[model samples]
Target: MEGVSFPPLSRFAVCCGTHGNEMTGVYMYRHLQKQKVENITVTTILSNPRAVDACKRYIDIDLNRCFTNALLCTAITDSSPYELRRAQEIDAEVGPKGSDEAVDLLCDLHNTTSNMGLCVMYNSSDCVAMHIFKHLKSKITSVPVRAICSDEPISEGYALDSVGKHGLSLEVGPQPNGVVRADNFNVITEAFNHIIEWLQQFNSGATFEGGVEDVYKMTEKVDYPRDLNTNEITAAVHPQLQDNDFKLLRTGDPIFLSFDGETLRHKGRELYPFFVNECAYYEKKVAFILGEKVTVAFPSISVTKN
Candidate 1:
């Protein structure tokens, strides 16, 4: 996907430290905002300054989760959650959800505590997104371009990326919360730079394109085993699956181990599981997200984001 850059292309780079403790995005945004790229114009934002300052995930609500159209249209006031008003401010800055000021592409930076080394998430089956991941997979090490498709039928407004035209959220992890790993930080920087260079090339009349890619699109969100009476999580992620993100699991594979001696097994078809036992998702009851790998053939077939 390497090509000579010519003219500039305008885009937006928003690093929402919505979960402020996820420092990969925060630190990378700080670095990239300082160094400017030519021809490829960008509007970078540190989405949650206060949360980052407190060294916590969020103040009231997750800022990234406050972007649904209904929420965006709401009037901000002193009574509202900090994230609610902050979302409104950010929507105005880079995007008022489809206005002229809205960036052509939105790059939301994120990180996870799971062993998910590098995951690229997009709204739908966007060919442009596929092409970007294809190029990135070939370049990044330790992990390939594992893509997550957040296909929303209606405006969920639960993420910062949902407010833009064409956008992708870059999640890099296995690092803990509230701290920066130089190695992880370096990978994040490299991935973003690669995308920027690729975008410049594409806008400059180069087709940094790919034909097809095998991406694991999220099919269902699996919650941890909970005690029905007390609603407390009763089981934990199986030892076999720990740090085994992106590995294909077949029918009857161990997925969870109960507090007692029983083991919970997967009974469905072969599937790929990532974000296995993510710490932040514990509150949401998401033990892990179950996904299926599908071939995304580009150019030949037109796949819309809707």
Candidate 2:
């Protein structure tokens, strides 16, 4: 494939606090609000301010899940949920999504209780996002940088970043909710610094050489073992699987350890696992997500000269 040129990414948004307890983003939003970059119209947003004030993930529903077109276009009513209303308000600010008025790029900051390092997540095979991931992989050496493609269509994307023309989420962790670890915080700081640098270079017409890179495409989610009658979790992630995000899991490998001391093994073909035992996923009923690792090829990209 030939190199691709995209319009300069002028209007950019860095959003945080989509999940209120993810303190890294909550604080990063405040940190970034003080900084500025030349030529880029930076819009810093503290998404879900009420959730941040209360230090809860959300009040009525997950704000991150409220961005689907069906939900965003729904009419506001006297009893609309707080997050749905907030989503609309945010869409009005940075989005009104899938329109030309949306920001050129949006990076949503998030933290996880799982041990995944610095992971960049996107909904599609966007060249600009791929280039940004490639640049971050080169610049940020403190932690492993990886990319995950959820493969959802933009209009159906449920996250805040989906509001932009080009969007990705910077998710880092092993940090506990409501607590900020200096190490994790520094990783996010360095990442944003590098992202800003990449943007500046791209806007200046720098042609980034692209090649094949490994990306994990999310396949399916695994839920915790539960009692049929009680509807309560009956087992925990096996010690072997705990904190082992991105490890390949083979059929017959231990996946869960029951309270009664019996071990449960994996039952399917081999695949990589991520978000293993996420703290927030307890409510979502996801023990972890499995993904298929595949190499993706991208073309060299540069800002189209006006």
Candidate 3:
């Protein structure tokens, strides 16, 4: 892991508990807000606070998926669904959508039931994001950083981190929903502190020159085996592939297994699998994402490919 000539950050935004039951981020955010740091002002949001209190994933819909432009349009007129309205409110507070002017950066924190480790997920090819990603990877050399850039035409991007400025979502897991593991908490807290200190260093006129060798870029999303008639998931992640996030999946790799003991193997080209069997993804129909490993250099035009 190397460093980048990161720029100074002034105002920052963080959305915690976006999924409600992911308590690691919620607890971490609660811990961070009470402390004071210099050179950067922050706007902290406890997204889906009601859901957090209820110990549920969401009060209505997943806030992470409800922040798109097309959905936000409905959020304005409908105002009925809790998450839809909450998305609008969040946009006004820390997004480019409404009244609350977005700041210099944003970091939406999350946890998963799958073994995602610590991933810095982002959509765009913004240089600032690349710089930050480079810096975070340098801090935690073992953790993987992921880029989920949109390759197809989308009405708007999904996820809260996309709403604000040049930042990303940090997802750490293998912990169940509503449960906070000390190991996960310590890792997230360390990453949070690293971001703070990195920003402080940047503001104090620190410059760096670093580059990335390879990165996993999510190219497609795979759905779990579902019943066509009822549209219900009918299979589970194959035992052979469980907890195999960030691993290579070949054409004949086991992907899922039916309850009745039937196994389904992937018959596609080579790909890297991540977010396998994530609990929150059940509703979204996503079992995992198929990523393409590409040679890339940070802060270069090569990474700007969408």
Candidate 4:
């Protein structure tokens, strides 16, 4: 494939605290506020101040899910949800989504209760995000680095990062809500440093050699078994499957254990599971998500000199 060139990424945004209780990003956003970089404008935002202040996942709705074009274009009113209003404000600052004035790159930070370590999530069509994922995977040796691709267009993406011309979510995990684990925090910090280094190199006209990468493409969400009468969860993630993100689940593999001491087995074709037993996903009715591992090829890319 021929090399692809993109205009120099001059503006960047690092957004965190979209979930409020995800402490790694909240603190990282604070740390980044005091730092400066050369050649690029780095705008750091604490995405949801009120939610962060309360240490809650969100004020009214999940801010991470409020950036779809429809939501961003919605007319704000007194009855609008707090997060909806904040999403519009954020779009005005770093986005205006799908416009030329949007930031060159936007990276949103998040933490998960599941044991997915140092994962980058982005739309599969984003070559820049894919390259950044490859760079971070190659550079960060302290923890496992992986990428999850949502095979969709950026216009349909709902995450905060989707507002930028190129966007990705830097998600690290096994950390609980409202708490900061030192190891997880350090991993995220190192990732940001590497991302900045990559930006500097790309802006300086370095060509990045890209190749095939194995990524997990999100397929479906699995919810916990609920009681019919009370509509309450009746099963929990099996011990064998808990904290085992990225493990393949085959037919007959144990997935859930009912309160009555019955083991529930997987019934479908084999697929890798991620975000296993996530805390926040409980409310979202997602026990975990299943994905298929597939290899994607990206072309070498360089910054287009003006």
State the lDDT at 210 in candidate 3: 49
Superposition error at 236 for model 4 (Å): 0.7
The prediction achieving the highest lDDT against the true structure is 4
Report the number of backbone clashes for model 3. 0
- The whole-model C-alpha lDDT of candidate 3 against the native structure comes to 0.76
Candidates ranked by TM-score: 4, 2, 1, 3
lDDT of 3 by residue, 18-136 (tens): 88889997897789878797878978899898999998989977788887788777725554879888888988787764224667678898888888788777754555666666777
Ranked candidates (lDDT, high to low): 4, 2, 1, 3
What tens digits encode model 1's per-residue C-alpha lDDT throughout 94-190?
7877665677677788878888888888866455666677778888875655887766742554688766666778888888888789878888788
Q: How many backbone clashes does candidate 2 have?
A: 1
Provide TM-scores for the models: 0.90, 0.98, 0.87, 0.98
Model 4, span 1-306: residue lDDT tens: 678999998899999999999999999988898887888899999899999999999989999999999999899999999999999999999989999999999999999999999999999999999999999999998889999999887889999999999999988999999999999989988988888899999999999997999999988999999999998999999999998999889999999999999999999999999999999999989999999999999999999978
Which segments of candidate 1 are over 4 A away from where they belong? 1-8, 153-157, 300-306
| Local accuracy by lDDT, each model | 0.77, 0.91, 0.76, 0.94
Model 1 TM-score on a 0 to 1 scale? 0.90
Best of the two (1, 2) by lDDT:
2
lDDT of 1: 0.77
Best-fitting candidate, measured by TM-score?
4
TM-score of 2: 0.98
Worst 10 residues of 4 by lDDT: 30-39
The alpha-carbon deviation from the true structure for residue 184 of candidate 2, after best TM-score superposition, in angstroms, is 1.1
